[model samples]
Target: MASDLRTQDIQNPVDVAEYLFRRLHEVGVRSVHGLPGDYNLVALDYIPKAGLNWVGNCNELNAGYAADGYARVKGISAIVTTFGVGELSAVNAIAGAYSEYVPIVHIVGYPSTASQKNGMLLHHTLGNGDFNVFSKMSKEISCAVSLLNDQHEAATLIDNAIRECWLHSRPVYISLPSDMVQKKVDGDRLKTPLDLSFPKNDPEKEDYVVDVILKYLHAAQNPVVLVDACAIRHRALDETHEFIVKSGIPTFVAPMGKGAVNETLPNYGGVYAGDGSNKGVRERVEASDLVISIGAIKSDFNTAGFTYRISQLNTIDLHSYGTKVRYSEYPGVRMNGVLKKVTAKLGQLNVEKGPKPNNDIPDEEVKSPEPTITQAWFWPRLGQWLEKNDVVITETGTANFGIWETRFPADVTAISQVLWGSIGYATGSCQGAALAAKELGIKRTILFTGDGSFQLTAQEVSTMLRNKLNPIIFIICNKGYTIERYIHGWEDSYNDVQEWKYKELPYAFGAEKDSVLTYRVSTKKEVEELFLDREFASGDTQKLRFVELVMAWDDAPVALKSTAAAAAKTNAEN
Candidate 1:
């Protein structure tokens, strides 16, 4: 009474690729950004079949940036590339993701085991024929690395990498060898139901630290909460809003941590770092008696290059690793379990409303804004233009400014690969974002990018045309790398870029002439008219429009001077 059954088998490479692809889909990764190469042919073949969209980019760098952007909106994203050259090209974007703490999974294809054993200098082989070059590079970017050495390990490793990314809020690398992909494994052996839970602050020492913080807050006449990137990465947005509301403390978000709370909140103090920050933000921060920095890094950028005064006694630094009070006798406490414990204790105590600081500038002064092309001007204007339900994807350069400047409305959503300041990220990301938006029934998608960065992935314009997606792309044509110019003195040859007829790109990419539209403006008047026009829709073959604004390359955003000043002040203080 033995039963015989029909057995069906898939190629090893296809199986491995499909397994990983399905796993990604289950975890909410709908689109993958990448540059296809010979080494990754198997994965490429399986991508479309797995029901995941493959966003092809002009280069690996752009692909990485696009993935980073998608992650900013969706909380996590992935990038795929070939062995050596492809991985190396993506390093800049990956490093940016690391810096900003975006969750991106990088999948790199490698040479077969035979090639490694035979010591062939195959295509993309780094003289050693070892894939560790990518492993080491990824490690340098502070990302966790895993290799699919065995077929059985592929699913587990892929799951591990994704989990690690969610936990660490950083990029993770997975190297897939060519031959191992298609091998079969017990379907039950695959990881079951991946968890997205983040590591929390430790509870054991929470009572003591919470007591100390509460004591300081009660005694202080003025207190403030400084929100930073870690808060956003930890998905503590709601918790932060509740904490601020309960405490009745004014709040300031780090430049990289903007949109953590409603900007329209009564206690909102504005951005304290980067372009949109007010001139008096540092003074307000320094004047505070107690500063509670929740999930903030003590990095130079977030701390105004360490320029502003933070009494080691008054600072409470909270991070994933632990909690510490600077310049205090209190010992650092592990944070994994501390936040809940601290919140529980503090939740029991009655928080009293204190006198609010007069941080607002007078209407007259605020009206006569400073003459700078900073986030102050950019964000508010952009905010006004955005609809309640629209999705905003920011490229690295101007996008960083938008993070600091723009206020998130109730229905408006914002996304950027802040961790990876990869140029040319916004264009391809726009494609992914638009696709996702369409799938979700979101009508409008907008992209804000700089001219220099846009050129890096301009090829994706054709992809948009092919998909028939209508996304309004705003190219800030300053004609150079403005961020670099601010960090290091501008070198004309290095920072300057040739001006492009940006509005013409759509037509060059086979977009229907009537369906595509172009707008070039230098003044505010023209910007208002073109930005508000309702005719710019996907169906209007006459509407594949590109708007180019002529801005000065030397025009530093608002935060640049403040940052420089803060650095100088820190140097003097030190």
Candidate 2:
């Protein structure tokens, strides 16, 4: 028997665009971000009618970034763009979503079915007349692709694409031809919510695996849990935290997993990215008898260029799809189910709370009490000032590296292009994140980005201002590509960037004087004063706040300096 969640025998016909937008709404996408072009303008017409907000981005690329940011907060997001030109422009952002396990639905408005069949030379199409090229390129980045023309298949195709996106935690593509906008299709699928849940393991196999894991758990004198990025992507944080609490195990997070677990947890160890980790964390994690890693993505940067010393022999790795108990692999096991079972079984064992881990920044390392603003001083101070549920989006360079040292408060979510490492992503994404946060009743959206990276997508700030969002943006003015300078050449002129008077950008971007707040901080006292200011600290929604923090060109976070040295050596060898 089919599930009752489906509409049994009733079939309602609705416009293809209506059905698509309604389905997206049913799945929690309240807004669709994109730029309108000739090909997609008609589809954009249905957006407001279907009760979805049309977030008019300045460009296709910024739309993609906004969609990614929204997806990170809202679990799923959609972006609409025109065919060749618009889609191609958003490809880099889509690629970042893929690399970082963000689920986004990329909807492209293509030429009409008749135009494609006749190979009509459309305004947006290449003169060569192949309309299939963009979809082919999108296939490389999207988990699922659906090119729709027939209304009969549109419902299933759209559902399938969304399912794949949800199941894989990655981006999917949907190409809607202009002719199919009003075609009547079955709206039956809209009654049934998407079943993105993973299949359960065989009961016997699951029990056997759990028992074996419990045996390992029982014998270990020192067991530790390492949380990684997938813990958030897989929606396994609750189970992960339960396991950690029940077992009383020491827990550490990877660089990519910064905000997944609450840093305020008693057993919480700091980030464990090899040498980049807090002092003594590496020793405790490496010396543990068993290290259970949940959804770990050991990207070079996350692991400090593969400097992790934990042996696979003593590691039990749990992922979205499977679980590996040291040498044995359970292919069908899901981390959600596996973690639940482990937490239950953990109650049967007498687990002792380990020594209290020291995850704090030492007083001696805080700052030189110097007048100059340094990363060590700035990051920790920012950490202290951060409130609960503040969403932090960091750019790919110095800001990204600097964020690793900052401890996130409870329910604080962090968004970044860590694996993709795309420069200038945060500025555009901050706009989307701020909007999403507003929609979800999250008050504060904070962005940290470097001067060079910020220049890449600075225009998105105009979009934020237009939307009346209040995101506190901190622009680190190092005056160059600081991360690149460390990676290849420390003194090379190629890494330098042109200076911008960032404090005046809000006014230059057409923001009304009272609607925005601007500040420049060159000294530690200034930064501290800004933190203490009610308007700055509380982030008054009436005004968008922008801060330019001036630092020496060569200054960088300690983690960035160390990882860059290793990265530089690796690049030289390659």
User: Pick by TM-score: which candidate is best?
Assistant: 2
What digit string (tens of lDDT, one per residue) describes model 1 on residues 1-574? 1111111332223367777777778777888888888888876877777788887777787677667767766778888999899999988878888888888889988888677778787777767766466678678785578788776566778778888888888899888778866655445434467887754334545677777776776677777888877777766666666677666677887756655656666677766753335555666777777788877765565544554566767888776666777555334464434444445545433332322323233354357644434343455666666665677777656456545545566555566654444567678778767766765677777887888888778988887777677788888888788776766547757877788888988888888767767778776556667656778533222245577866667665555545655545565674
- Model 2 TM-score, all chains together: 0.96
The total of clashing pairs for model 1 equals 28
Clashing pairs in 2: none
Please write out the lDDT profile of model 2 over residues 1-574, one tens digit for every residue: 3433333443686788998898888788998999998888889999988899988998988899989999998999999999999999999999999999999999999999999999888787778889999999999999999999776678889889988888898999999999989887767667778887777777887888788888998888888889999999978989998888777788888989989888878788778899888667888888888988999999888988778999998999999878899989999888888889978877554343443433244476553566888777677777888999999999987788887777777889999888888888999899889999999999999999999998889989999988999999999998889999988878888888889998788888899889988999999889879989998878445689999989989888888888888888887784
The runs of at least 3 residues in candidate 1 whose Cα sits more than 4 Å from the true structure, single-residue gaps closed, are 1-14, 189-191, 199-202, 274-276, 300-305, 328-379, 393-399, 402-406, 411-425, 432-443, 482-494, 536-545, 552-554, 564-574
